[model samples]
Target: MEYNLEVINLTKNYQDFHLQQINIKLPKGKIIGLIGENGSGKTTTIKSILNLMTYDKGNIKIFGKDSRNLTKQEREKIGVVLDDSFFSPILNVNDINKLMKDFYSNWNEKFYYETIKKFKIPDNKPLKEFSSGMKMKIKVLCAIAHEPKLLILDEPTNGLDPIFRYEIVELFNNFVSNGENSILMTTHITSDLEHLADEVIFINDGNIILDVLKDKIDSEYGIVELLENNFNNIKKEDYLKCLKYKNEWYILVNPKYEFQKKYPKLKVRKPNLEELMLLLVKGE
Candidate 1:
């Protein structure tokens, strides 16, 4: 099977933090969610893939070719949306369209206009005058209008309202339905990934701690609730993590053994991605 993006033993070192040996593969036509806490090296890993940051080790391949050796045509097939704005603050939507047209050989003016209209952005307004949400939409429009095969997004949903976020998520879903494109988006919003991501990659302290299919997570990890008093009898080692509330305790467990049968009174239930991530990151 072909892959849209692949990272092999990728490592980057900073003065105070190190992004340890990282390996990830993004299959073609799938939306892979890269979830991590702040300063977890998500951005660093993305920069390494884009060749925007210098890394000490590992190989990055895009479209089955080494990223380092990518020609201009190969580079044009990837669209990137980082946390920082790429367009000039003084430039209007119209100006941005014209500028990007010069950069991407496959830039589709018709698609650009349609995206702008769909997002309800005014072509004449200066980008600085637009709200954060509008600015993000403009970035999205610019990135997608070029008809890139892969999109690398860093916190693309950060400033949007809930309604817009949902709309954007659906847009991404539709975008990948064609099975010729893919996206690798890094976000802290686990809820977004729960619905849209086929695969999930969790990064912590500059290292990948969990990488699995979302469906597997749903089938493997479960939440077990017990009375506060009974919590003391539940072994901590048996659970991935646990939490205590005022009157009850909730634990995340991988119930592959007969342990649940032994503790018949434990209330077992399913957990969403948010709960799983909280447990995994907390190590509680």
Candidate 2:
């Protein structure tokens, strides 16, 4: 199947940070979660793909067209929610709706009004008067109102309450159910992705460390908690990451079958996204 988005050899350089040869692909009809620590190049990668920043070396394609040379029509197929509100704070929800209708030819005024109502956004209140959570909801509302085929979300759920967050996640699930739409989101809430993501990409300090389907990760890797004495006994090559507390060891390993079979005395459990990320990001 053709990919909805593809990035090959994506590289960027800054005074103190570098986004090295990052490569990623998002297939149609899938929600891929991008996870990284603060300043790990998630925003940089998104900006590069959005043509907001120039990269030194790489090719980014969306809808099989070069990202850098997208036509107006091609650009319309994407919906973006960045870290901050891109519009003027003086604009109210109604004003935003009017502006977007003028900008995106496909904008659905009906849907926009309904969504704002559903999200409990006050039409007359200026964006500057809204709380952070309210601002985030407006951004999300604006992004989906045009019915784009692809969504590029950066910290999409920041400042959202749990109730709204859950609702948005459910909306995302429905968005891709038709098998034509796709989403690339970077969120700190790994728990949300643990439930909604089809695949997870882990990036660290500019390098792509792991990119795998959620199912494959669960089936292929397992976390083993080992006592100090048992840590040296397991085969080291099996370990993808290992961390030590006071005396216990948290080991993330591949070929889980072999490790589990060999060490019947230890318990092996599937690690959630957060646990896996912690091991990869914090462990040695």
Candidate 3:
């Protein structure tokens, strides 16, 4: 019933871009997907929550404690995977496993080796000799084998094949099924989120465009296509974004009863996550 992580009024200013007043609540036993374009402050937000970067304003809490106040034991309960891995390239998989066993208080040696076997990762080969996908698999294995309460990942399945992506997502599903763990992942691949995320947070240009349950997306939001003649009749306030191309107006709107009553003849249809994302980011 409690949130695993809370980000409130988060803001950070830079010379060229700003992460402004972002907020999110990630409940335990749920996976929340974060989607945004490159340089849209997705990584910045994650880093801010991890306290890897200094923020100018707002509070970030994990497991009911301010992130900065977490003890070594508390910090160990968070398993993280960034866009890049931090393991030394010269270290082989066996070496990494040995290091991890010593680092985490409750490291599961059985689970770690099982994961390596499942992933088909070579224990004797150094990371530098592995492909990007292989290295990513190792990182994922390391994160999950520790049995953390929360997993924060960025682009965790970037280079994997479709089958493995599904497997990894299945792992996420299993991780949260017990209602004791949760995950917050930022991914450019909306399809992955569509399959795994219970809720989604869409950010654009450092601002939150959407943050809602995935099921509510279809029921509450839609795209409306209007003929050229009717385009001028629709009010701008009704739609979140609009575009005029090929003599038709494409608009995304909440489809409230009032808007539908006003234009019963308008064509409104449900959009999938990827389509909706595109309309919001590129429609205007």
lDDT of each: 0.86, 0.91, 0.88
**lDDT ranking, high to low:** 2, 3, 1
Candidate 3 residues 141-193, lDDT tens each? 88888889999998999888898898999999999999989999999988998
Q: Write the per-residue lDDT of candidate 2 for residues 104-178, one digit (tens) a residue.
A: 999999998888888888899899999988999989888899999999999988999999999999989999999
Best by TM-score: 2
Q: How would the candidate models be sorted by TM-score, starting from the highest?
A: 2, 1, 3
Q: Give the clashing pairs for model 3.
A: none
User: Candidate 1: lDDT over CA atoms?
Assistant: 0.86
Q: Which residue ranges in model 1 land beyond 4 Å of their true spot? A: 245-247, 255-262
Tell how far residue 120 is off in model 1, in angstroms.
0.9
Q: Candidates 2 and 3: which is better by TM-score?
A: 2
TM per candidate? 0.95, 0.96, 0.91
The weakest ten consecutive residues by lDDT in model 2 span 232-241
Higher-lDDT candidate of 1 and 3: 3
> What digit string (tens of lDDT, one per residue) describes model 1 on residues 1-284?
77999999999888999999889899888999998889998999999999998899999999999999999998898888888857778999888888998999999999889888888899898988999989998887777888889999998898998988999999889889999899999988788888899999989998998898988877776788778778889887777788766677778888533456767766667788777777788747
